[model samples]
Target: MRYLLPGRAAWAVSLTRTIVALVTLFSVATQLAALSVQPSTATFSLDTTTLTIPQVDYESAIYYRDGDPYPHLDFERVDRRRTVRKDHTAVVMENRYVKLTLLPEMGRVYSFVYKPTGHETLWQNDLVTVGGAANDTGWWLWIGGVEYTLPGDEHGTTWAMPWSWEIIENSSRRKAVRMRVREPGTGLEESIEIAIVSGRAFFEARICITNPTDGMVEYAHWVNPQWTPGGQNELTDRTEFIIPTDRILIDERWQENLGPSPQAWQGNPLRFIRGWSRMGDVMADGLTGGFYSAYSHDADEGIVRVFDPDKTPGVDVWTYGYHPTQIPMGSGGPNAGYVEMWGGTSRTYPDERWPLAPDASLQWTEWMYPYQRTQGLTFANEDAAINFQVTPEARRVVIGLCPSGEWRGAVELWRESVHDAADGRAPLRRWEVTADPATPFIKVVILEGLMASEFNDLRLRVGSDQDGWTIVEAEN
Candidate 1:
């Protein structure tokens, strides 16, 4: 899979007198032809590799606090004395568009690379350090990547422990690895099946939490990913968070730096990581859509995480700040600043918890993928991401589409709103194109002599005639 757009001749189409020129920039014509004749079956590969990791060594001791608060949990204290090298096992799964790497020792995703661009979407540490203390554990590992934090607050207790893994699927269409760990405090089981399927751009993680106790239990489950979508495991000032929520709650500790809670995010300066001077967490009060993302304007690349808003309504953001001493200690460098996007089962962490009955399990699915060449993202679903922006002053309309799989269809732009087929309205302009995970469709339409106010009514529809069209509203 290639990220750079293939070199192709550009042609212009004149649809009407007001439509000055329509240029098709990126189209996967050759790929479409090859896919047409290929079999419908999906193909993927799964394997294991050993990695020599550089980490800090610590002398640790575990003790139980009797008659103290939270007596059921054990605490650990560590003396970070020296650095050492260790070998860890890594499970890899790959498809046409993406490659996923998981570490059973850490029980988290170590790396997620967009094969097209050869870019790692997750923030990975160069050196691991376990020192910080949290609510549930006395020592927290600062190793990067996505970790499933559960059954306790903060970084949780099982993140630094070794997990049991097995290859659950080896079919032609799909390949997956399941990682399971039981929390020592609660004896609750956490199982995650990370899989890749043929012809799809995104990888899916099916997470299941089981309660084995004889009575009811309350816990908090969060999927936490340290993101640096710009690649090379670094963050920049141009990185913009694409959260589809009107209001958010800022943690009290960061209120002075991030602003008041239950406030609008449209004009918030901290929406970009550069605006923060200190570490903090920001959480969405509610979600207007099913996806949230982060895009780097300088790199022209972005990553999206899609989940059911009803099932996982909690979305939070955490950062180490632009300048932090922990970055050097944790990653062995000062340039590894990254943002954390967390998806949770409840609205708030620690404050809110979900109850589970004995022998019952809760499960949900999430998809993560990369997209490029879009100025920004307005809306996204499992199928595609739509970027539609109109400049009324310049009479320019820019449209971009990044699909998860092969797509052959017509992209139509209408001057007036078309509610139904019986409206008998014609589109102002239409173009037929083919796209895929590696290929994105971008077009710039210059509508000459059109009033500036008319641009507000423009709407876009994309799909094949056989599959029906999906209407996407314009964002100015």
Candidate 2:
């Protein structure tokens, strides 16, 4: 069965949802106004002025997949009923820098838009589709944006069902919303709290998974953030999905994207193999860096996802090969290529699944930053000191550094020529700068004598004079 919600019907449904949400908000406000607050001895304040969460119905097309594990039927005529009910609500959380729209009914992010560039960071599907009777996985629903997978990887049972959400806290400094669901199959409780500040360019996602059972239960906690590097209109082949990992573990069933092959790879199975070829695909072997970035050099806009290594030990990058034409079950349009930077508890795919005993819970925080010209990120800390730069040339290049708090250290810059790329990269030319702890670490370098043609790579390392140089790790 398949159904498509056209623009007119979608607008009607959205209007209805908005009216209902406004009435509900008015009623709640009236009730809260009747309460009397006693002035306390301590200073306490809460602000909900800038925070407004309204509901709207999103229109999309949905259908079932039967031919392969994950298939997209392109046939036009719909055997199923054309008239489908708009049963889901899109909760929009907007701030100064970005706006996050979520569907509570499905516990999925409908869209994440960066307001500065008016670009969406998540790859979104315009039509809402569901699996048919033959596909009994319960996860028949598929749309773009970030979707949470709990109790197990892939789409768990909870994703197809509705989740409960509420604005837990509202303040002038920040606004926070919490969405949660309980897995019926495993009695696991998964919740995600998203918070955004007033003028910040980044947002935070705190994911918590709990095993309520008395016996030991093995589960994987992964923050699967998907984005089409070049957005929906641009070609994905021009985008680069950068994961700082030396080795990549691949699924054996993943069919190699042979250039002349008549068909593309289908389905996303949970199996892992020792090695795989990079080939024409744009993906790294495995991710070694605590952060992953996908950027379109041509467009000069991209996003960066940073995770705390102490909490999230495993990170990897998964990207569907660059296809100029429309692929089955892909994002909305032609240039829409899929790239998912996964931060999980296990190192490689299925290599290790976290074991949680009764009443045990695992939680972690993920930070996402959207930028206009951030070519790539070398390293990042929890609070600040996110170091990245654009295309590096020998003579001079502009480096973007975000250093805050007590960052009293020296940032060292190095360059490696293409000729020295075989062995290990050694520091050819060194330039160091020391800055105050309270200043922002944004610096532009002028490699006066160095020629742009001679260098193939640029490196940034941080340390004090006493400590030499060290990798940039998250420091509280």
Number of the top-ranking candidate, with TM-score as the measure: 1
Give the whole-model CA lDDT for all candidates, comma-separated: 0.72, 0.51
Looking at model 2, how many pairs of residues clash? 16
Worst 10 residues of 2 by lDDT: 266-275
Off by over 4 Å in 1: 1-43, 59-81, 323-332, 448-450
| Candidate 2 regions with alpha-carbon error over 4 angstroms | 1-87, 131-138, 230-235, 258-287, 324-335, 350-352, 382-398, 402-476
Tell me model 1's lDDT, rounded to 2 decimals: 0.72
Compared with the true structure, what per-residue lDDT tens digits does model 2 show for residues 1-476?
11122222222234444445345435433332222133232212322222222222212333446443332332233322232334345555555455666666567765666655656678643333333322224334435567777555544446554588888877777767788988765678999987776555566888888988888887766666777644552324456555565444444444353222122111121111111122222223444557776666666666777787667766655544445233223112233345666667766443357788899888888887666543344555444435445333435555545432234555555653323334776553344544322234465556665655543455555665575545432111
**lDDT per residue as tens, model 1, 378-467:** 778777777888999999999988888787898899876666646776788888979886788889999996899999899898886698
